[model samples]
Target chain A: MEQILANGLYLGAQYALIALGLTLIFSLMNVLNFAHGQMYVFGGFVTYTVVAQLGLPFIVGLIASAVVLAVMGALIEKFLFRPVIRKSKRDESTMLLAAGIAFFLDAVILLLFGEKQRGVPKVVNGVFNWDMRLIMPYDRILIAALAVALIVGFILFMQYSRTGRAMRALAQDRVAAQLMGVDVDRYSMIGFALGAMLAGLVGGLLVTITGINLGMGGPTSVKAFLMIMIGGAGVISGAIAGGFILGMMESVGLTLLAAYGDVTYLVIFVTLMIFLAIRPQGLMGKPWG
Target chain B: MTDQTQTTPIVKGSAMSMNRVLGVGAFLLGVFVLVPVIINLTGRWDFYYTLTSVALLSVAAAGVWLTFYIGRINIGQGAYALTGGYVSAVLMTQYGVSFWLTLPLAGIFCALVSVLIGLPILRLRGVYFAMVTLVLTEVARLTALALPITNGAKGITSIPLPGELSILGLTIIPDFATLENPKLAFYLMAALLMVLTYLVLWRIVNSRLGHLCRSLQQNEELSASIGVNTAMLRVLSYAISSFFGGLAGAIFVAISQSIYPSSFVVQDSVNFMLYCFLGGLGYVFGPMLGTLLLYFGWDLLSVAKEYQLLIYSGALIALMLVLPNGILSLLDKKGGNK
Candidate 1:
């Protein structure tokens, strides 16, 4: 039970970070950002190239990933999403554009990073054994601590920062914020960049543990969608709660249903479908918001 | 300047006319008679396979288009396609059922399953519905992997070709295996299905049901207040949409004589919506034209080799940006001028 709890907590921290970026962009632009998983994978590759190929320190590699992804996200919003949303009559047109960008990124990632899985040298090396009841690597413990710190830092930034307040207003009501002198376009771009940066940070942090590959992009995006849906779409606290709930479910399901093979995800997906049917707005989200 | 009253007559008569009849006749002649003759002269027999696949893909895209018609972004058509393939494969190989018998059975099964799934999810807001449906293809894949009757990871293979399809005492279609060139036969079969699918779609769009669906698309709350059975319409369209997807999948399995969990993945589902978007979401035949253009365009880009996907995706993004309403919208503008 202690082992499962530890595993869930570690998984929850990372999963929450991934969900945070996606929900942020969704709230700001009402675009689902299908390329989010690709952005995450791109971040992992940036970190890999920096640390493994260039022989740079891991911290520098992590910063490089965040910077690269933020720029990409900003440019995509300005050039692709913003213009498309403005010109198109239908709102769903953005979904097509996002999916196209996802394909474009997947192709780009393949060409640049290749198809093989990549990992960096571990930052720390030692197994933490606690009374033989729970075992975890020291690297995992550090990554989890860093992830929790980042989440707390993000919440603080959103709560107190000037730019964060403007973004919150824009998300709450775009026209109202515009009327109140908020720069709608600029803030939207920033929100997208910030969301993407979070994805990159998580990718870079987890690269040492799970490694990264080209194929992980689609599944990662799907899992992130599931997280956001469970927590309530576009809600920060809900994302964190959904993340921990999913992490706990996964940990427990995997261990208990070990003899039954890979039925955990199937059950979880069905349950999510039923849960969404019962509560379309999610646990914390407003209807259609 | 023309008055509004004069334009109404033109708009009403536009649905049927001598010019429209001739245009459709030309299109039919071009597809059925001219293409095969050109392929024979060029000796590019493989073009048959490419066109057949396009025809089948467009059928599924038509289903996606229907959901879009009802104001839903359906990224779950692949699930129905996969389910249909598995149903047909399992029945033909395991239950000793004939291929012809399993085709409608697959479609009906998919329709039934979709109704069960769509009832609850369809009630959500469009955005929430989109998000929920997005995971459905993955869920279908996982279910396929876990289910024992699906033959697990190996998938069902080596299924027999579609046998002779007949009605009463007449043999309408001969067994595919006995044909001299099954490629041509498969192409004809798929083309026939495509034409039939679009005709039905065109009919539906012109009917009273289609008007209610359009109202739902425009404003669901207003439509519901005005006495529309909004829930039933949504679910009915969804069922019909999944039926088309299932039929397409069943035909696809017959063409390849195999079924696998990975056969219809999430990319294919997204591409179906892309087809509708590329052609023109408002038009009935949009998906057919979109599928033809995309499939051929991809084939043409094969010469790019390593940069093929990069170029293809880049072109797709550019095209969506340039033609936000779709390629057919350009035609609509020119047609409206008259």
Candidate 2:
């Protein structure tokens, strides 16, 4: 039971970190940004390049990736998404559009990078043993810690900061916020960039746990989608809840179906379908409005 | 300007063009029929099977085009194909059912599965629906892989050749068996089936149901408010599409004589959809063009697998960037102007 709890926390933190970016983008632009997973892949690859090839400090690689991807996100919104967005009838079309773009990018990346599992040197390697009966990696512990800190920081930023307030206002009502003197476009641009930046952060952290490759985007993006659906769209708190739920479920599933490694994905999808049917508005239904 | 505004002239011109189109279509059909004969004359009759493969893929792609007609991009259509293949293979391998009965049964079974899955998914909108279907396909695939009944990813093999049947005293036997040549059988069955499929689709497009599908794509709420029974129509379209997919799968298994999980992956779904989109989603001939173009490209670019992906991806991005409506749209516009 303790092992399950620990496993869930470690997995949950990773999921929550990834889902935060998805929720932010979904709320602000009402777009699912299917390519958000590609951004995570970008994060992993760039970090690998810096740490593995360039021999830079892992921390420096993380920071640099965040800056670079944030800019990329802003540019994607300005160019690809801006004009065609109105052509999209619903959030679904926007997601499809983004996914098409991601498919192109992923293929290009795979061509350049090749389909090989690559990883960065672990940050604070080694495992922590509790009474010799429980052993957990220190890196996962660091991930959980960092995830908690980021969640706290995200909450404070949304609650207290002026820019964050503008972001919230834009997410709640784009036209109303514009009428109220908020620069809706600027908020969206910033939100997209910041969301990407967070994804890059998670990407760097993820490489420490699991290897990175071009194929990671599809599975990662699906998990993030499931998280957003379960937690509710447009609510940061809901993202946290949704991520943890998915994370714990996945961890438990992996444990139970250890013989069938891929079975976890099926469990996650089945659980998500059931949960969404029951609470279409999501876990934090009131706050989603 | 006066001539342009005249409906009689435009209508007459369009009617004339329609006649030309039918003539051209018939010419193309004739060429398609003669492909095997021409290959046989060249002493490379084995190429006939490859052509049959293309025909089967085209039929499956055409089936998927039905769902696309309703403005829903279902990534789970491959699930139906996989299911159909597995059902036919299992029945043939385990229960020793005749291939003739198993063939049509596969289509019916797949249609039923499509309705079952489409029920929950139909309620989902946009990307959520697409993503959910993708996930569902994966789950279905994984379940198939795990089940011992499927040989657990080793895949079902040695599926019997479709048996002869006597319906209304026709005593139909597969052509290849009588000719003692596989290529002859392939060309006769696949080419004929494809021609029939195309005709069926053409009829559908000209029918009222096709107009309703287009209306559903344009605006769902407005169609519903107009008493279109939009949901039922969408479900019906989905079921019909799955039937085609299943039929294609059954034929696919019959030709290949094996069914495996690897043959039906998420990438297969993505590839078919890509073919549809690249061919031009709105055009009836889009899938055929897409299948021919994409398969030819796939053959040409087989050397550099990684670069092929990059180029394919680059081309897709460029296509969307340059021709949002797809390659067919350019021809369509040119045809319209002419």
True contacts kept of each: 0.65, 0.28
Residue A178 of model 1, lDDT score: 100
lDDT of residue A215 for candidate 1 = 93
Tell me the tens digit of each residue's lDDT in model 2 across B157-180: 887677777788797774344657
lDDT of 1 by residue, B114-163 (tens): 99999999987756777788789988988999999998779999999999
lDDT of 2 at A179: 98
**DockQ, 0 to 1 scale, candidate 2:** 0.36
Candidate 2 residue spans exceeding 4 A from truth: A86-97, A132-134, A158-170, A173-188, A233-235, A257-262, A284-289, B1-24, B27-31, B37-53, B163-184, B303-305, B331-338
Cand 2, B chain, TM: 0.87
List model 1 lDDT by residue over A1-289, tens digit each.
9999999999999999999999999989999989999999999999999999999999999999999999999999999999889977688888888988998999999999999999999999999999999999999999999999999999999999999999999989999999999999999999999999999998899898899999999988988889989988888898888888888889999999889988899889999999998998888997865
Measured on C-alpha atoms, candidate 2 has an lDDT of: 0.76
Residue-level lDDT for A28 in candidate 2: 89
